[model samples]
Target: MKDGDETRQREDTPFYDHPTGGWGSLKSVARWMVKGRPSPGVLDTLRIQNKPGGHMCTSCAWAKPPNPHLAEFCENGAKATIWDLTRDRCTPDFFARHSVTELQGWSDHDLERVGRLTHPMRYDAASDHYLPCNWDEAFAGIGARLRQLDPRSVVFYASGRASLETSYLYQLFARALGHNNLPDSSNMCHETTSVALKSTIGSPVGTCVLSDFEHCEMILFFGQNTGSNSPRFLHPLQQAVRRGCKIVTFNPVRERGLIEFTSPQEPGPMLTGGSTRISDTYLQVRPGGDIAAIAGLCKHLFALDDAGGGVIDRDFIAEHTDGFASFEANIRETGWDGIEAASGLIRADLEAVAEIYARSPRSIGIYGMGLTQHVHGSQSVQMLVNLLLMRGNIGRPGTGISPVRGHSNVQGQRTVGISEKPELVPLDRLAELFGFEPPRDEGRTTVDAVQGLLDGSVRGFVSLGGNFARAIPDQGRSDGAWAGLALNVQIATKLNRSHVLVGDGTWLLPCLVRAEEDRQASGSQTVTMEDSLSHIHGSVGRRAPASGHLLSETAIVAGLAKATLAPNPRLAWDDWVGDYALIRDLIEATYPEEFKDFNARMFTPGGFYRGNPARERQWKTTSGKAGFTTPTVLSALGAEPGDAVFTLMTLRSNDQFNTTIYGFRDRLRGLEGDRMVVLMNPGEMARAGLHEGQRVTLVSAVEDGKTRALPGMRVTGYDLPDGCVAAYYPEANPLVPLGWHDVESKTPAYKGAPVRIVA
Candidate 1:
């Protein structure tokens, strides 16, 4: 029941009351640096992060400002850099000291805390340990195993950590093996955003540039926690607030960063302990209620416009959009009673938000995972776009939809063709550039990949970089399915649960981290990353690799491809790995529209923005106009919770980023050395006959005949909606059923999980 370190008893913990991003952030950064004990040049490596001709921060994909501050990275960014640059190494000796079973007994945190992987390894089932293996033999064995299975039965999963060049090559490698089963980290996070935005505005990416915040009169946040997920974004929000911009937030939890923020870079705040108020209005909407809340805003806006308030942009809607009449009718037909019940907010609050929208000539709507991980996640996104469209928010300066992406290059990965859906990518261009007929069939998504494994249809899984076993939903089913795979391979930088959960033909190929230099046969190579706003920039690693045995991701992919497929006269895998510029040139050839002058544009100062047609009102939809759709469902979780049931939403701690747990201390949440605690509303706890600090188990309310329960969760009363509760992710991922996902996007419903507290 324990996870290495002792969980801080509830009696010893108090709620954090200080502002976000102040002295607390500095202390956390220093503590992490000390704990990680990064190499001597780690500080200098951080200095170039998000800077021109320097490596990008391996943290969130928040765009770097045109003129970045001297110390541009955030506390979490420092942790990620320090974590990647750690002196500790998981060597062959570490594997010799413990078997896979013994390592499985350790916490996720403990496994990674041992530090970066130092050598290539292949699992020896007889010895129950991973023995060091040369790259050649490992790739040969893997290629042989892969060749034995049907390409459709194999899954290639990638994390956002991979650079654009690496991702592009990864997809080509998969298709060369004869399938398009490419699923990346985006499938689990922002897949809904892509599906919805493409259907609505004809572009999958967000329309807002970072500078839009400065010019916007109002910024509305839904479901995103800026402080933890995208801390660097706080600078723009802080600046906007200083200029008297209106900031409104709607989330289940009252995040500290949305309430107030004190920038560490601000000398006045650091010296005087002053903090800038962030959200002028904070609404605690229920989990999975974003769609209803957005609908209410639209309804109120319609009412205002009907009364001749000059709220609706009639000219823009008539000129640039379609289905306005039906969209307006649906909004008007939806009763306030239903909206209030589903949203967990009164009509008055929505009206107030509508008033703010009406007053502001320019506005931006920002969202994150909170809105994306639900059964109606796609609909929720559409609703937000619908609300923006009512006021002609898109295709204008200081106004657009912004989905805060999690990983540094998650958006970039998708841009360079890491996708399951074949139609989303340019197949003709890929075939022309690579001299191979690419697969046209729809590939497997993360959810379908897990399903394929459970049903014995999938024989292999290859992850470019991610904690695949830990990050996926329904851990009980997924972990078992992973261990039963015919082949499992992880191209990674560090030790994690995924690497140890070995199966047949399992191999661990260590790769150079983001902060390390990636010198190939030609010369030192620099990879490019696309930020959330479509800005493409170069990232050239400066520090030495953690181990001499480490290979660049590009090299690893090339080695695997060369080993797997018979050499084609035109395909030069080794050549592409030797000089990345060649890879970029091919990328430009593949997507001339997006990556035109790819190599030249990537190194430009602050990078160039690949223009979005939606941003220019050049609608690429089938009807040649932005379309508005109506959502019939009021609640993402379906029916309302009966008696003891509560809507459970999983979230990340301040000490964590995605699935990587840096340490047990969550500074903003006031939890030290613990992550198994759940936050609940005081009234909700009292209603359920549970006291503060009560140790209880959470049982999934899904009627699947599966005993999905998480025991040993300490209850802590906090500020949240009355019928909603929050817990840390990956731990709570088991309670979320694999089938419970957005119907359109197939994104697992991690936010609106129905659960009941049991003693």
Candidate 2:
């Protein structure tokens, strides 16, 4: 296919884009090719086929069974299904056929072609082989190396997919082993949101629940794409629209999911060619300019309040919050000209949004990584809280702020206390429950962990679920730093780029996926997940084990703890992991108020609701109320004007998860079969004297002077704003320097890194 034709095919061409539904017919043909013939009695394998009453599918442990009557599978859920059910296996002989060095040259997809890893393997550098090793030997080797390092020198990272029991035990083991370096995926994604929310509302979670959307009169979605990113969210959004909720969107790219969505679950709507119109009004704000937009809206709202309009909730403001006087002063000082210039929005557009918010009886603001991946992410989040507070949105039905989390259990992980700096209260509880005081010193965060590896302060690394090296920024430096470690351990399901970037002593330990059942002494176990709305639900795996050698993350951590810290007199580690219930008991003992009746609540239909002081409009600040945080002089990008460098923004594809690629296709932007291309506006392309399909190197303009000249990078033209270009992460991460992170949040400014695009 021609490049243009290929781009067209990939770009926003939905399954319903074609007259006969583009992928519908092709999917049928592909199914026949694989299954020989379709039987009328044969159920659609891709659809949710199981009955509604079973425990979470033994295959991909989702919390609830699909309603046999409804659209049984979500888009990303389908991707996860195909990934798990693929009739391919990676056996010991496959490793024997190709040495580790040879396999290292293969792409992430090709490595998966060797199929699922069926046995435990250890990388031997001298022989260039990943030979099969027994579980005992693997555990012993990992334990001995971990014992060799000072506990502080070893970093334990967890991913959101890990069970609550596993996460609780992992943190317990790290504390028992004398370290607090529990840097997980949360640090990289929504740590800023948590920090901002906790400081402002006295809660680290969203105050609003999914039912709030139904009650909402107006919904303002900032920087989040619901359809492409979170398909399940489309249901609530569609329902809200049907209820006459006014939906306003602020995103750089006009996502199809935001404009119109045909329910994949509702066959009648799909057959009738009817779709839900999500956004009542769409505003494309410039990248890294969310704060300015929010500030402008607040300025407009304050103006209305001053004109005897009384849009502000004087009672709520007086009783529930502080620092309003100083906050109002900052908004007054910020001028319309500055806001317009920075946000790329006009005064009228700002007024229109403000008017909708002011007139509406109830409103909610939702945002995603787009607003939090910049240098002023925390400030931007605070601004959103400020906007909500202006109108008494909190502690009300259908009104509040929501940071749509990406992973299923990202919120749950943090709730269970997977943090680098566990608060003093939690630490006290840990000490009392576990009979040992956790190290009082704050340990490494995600960025700190990377720096520790670089400075040689960290010698060993253990990742529970995520691909840390690949998911982090500055992949070039991260690769080297990770490889330099004395021991690196990855517990994962599928093969990814991180697996190839091994340390001196590397171990790839396969573990049970969320879809698979985890059995222990406590009988069958079900893990809990916290959704974006702060609703905790149970996730029970139903699929059989993929390999007998594979261990549940809970068991793996327990085995490692036993092998490494058994000799220490800190605490009883083996007793905790012998049964996950003990771990849950400890967790409940530590956070009694939150996890009270923990086991009893798991059987509840929808699980439980985590307490949010903000929902009660009770601020948990030092002064016993919500407080507006006055941000210092804000600089969206630290780059100087007239500097010939373009800012790079890292993004995900429709066919991918955070760092896991289901395929190389980006169907939204019309990019096919390749992820190395950079998207730029036509005007910017012309300004740079570049043509379509031109390959260019991206050089970081940060102080470190890091350079990554990826050759054959197709320069595709898009509708992006001038002076900005977009590229896929992990590939484009080299363009971001380690030192160039958000000052307050310390989040890598992945969405805004100064770079010079060149041919």
The candidate maximizing TM-score is 1
Task: Write candidate 1's Cα lDDT for 1-759 as tens digits.
Answer: 111111222233355778899999999998888999899899898888888888799999999777889988999999999999999999999999999999989999899989889899999889999999998898899989988989999999998989989999899999888898999889898999999999999999999987788899999899998899889898999999999899999988768888879999889989998999899888888998888899899999988988999999989999999988988889899999999999999999999989999999999999998889888889889888988888899989999999999999999989888999899888887787668898999999999998898898999999999998888888767677777888999998888989877876899999998888999888899999998999999999989998999999999998898889988866788889889999999888877888888887887776789879999999989889998988879877744676888888998989999999998887787667768888886777777888887899998898887889999999987767778788999899988888888888988888888899997
| Pairs of residues at least 3 apart in sequence or in different chains that clash in candidate 1 | none
In every candidate, how many clashes are there? 0, 8
lDDT of 2 at 234: 70
Clashing pairs in 2: 11-670, 57-542, 58-542, 58-543, 59-543, 60-515, 61-514, 61-515
* TM-score (C-alpha, index-matched) for candidate 2: 0.92
Over 4 Å off in model 1, which ranges? 1-14
Q: Each candidate's lDDT (Cα)?
A: 0.88, 0.73
Candidate 2 runs further than 4 Å off: 1-69, 567-578, 633-635, 640-642
1-759: candidate 2 lDDT, tens digit per residue: 123532553462222232221234236335433532222222244443223322322222222322233544455555555565554666678777887667668876666545566787788777777778988998999998988889899999987767677888788889888888988877777777877888788887778876687799999888886665776567778889998999999877667677777665566876787777778888877777788888889999989989999999989899888999999999999989888877877889889889999999799988887777777788888888999998999899989988888776777777787888867238887776657777988878889988887899999999887778777777667666766788988887766677777756899888876556677766777666555676555556666667777888888888888888756454556665556667777778877877888777764554466677779877787889888877664435656323677778788876677777667766654457778988877778888899888888877777654565556678888766667888887678777777777666677888888877768
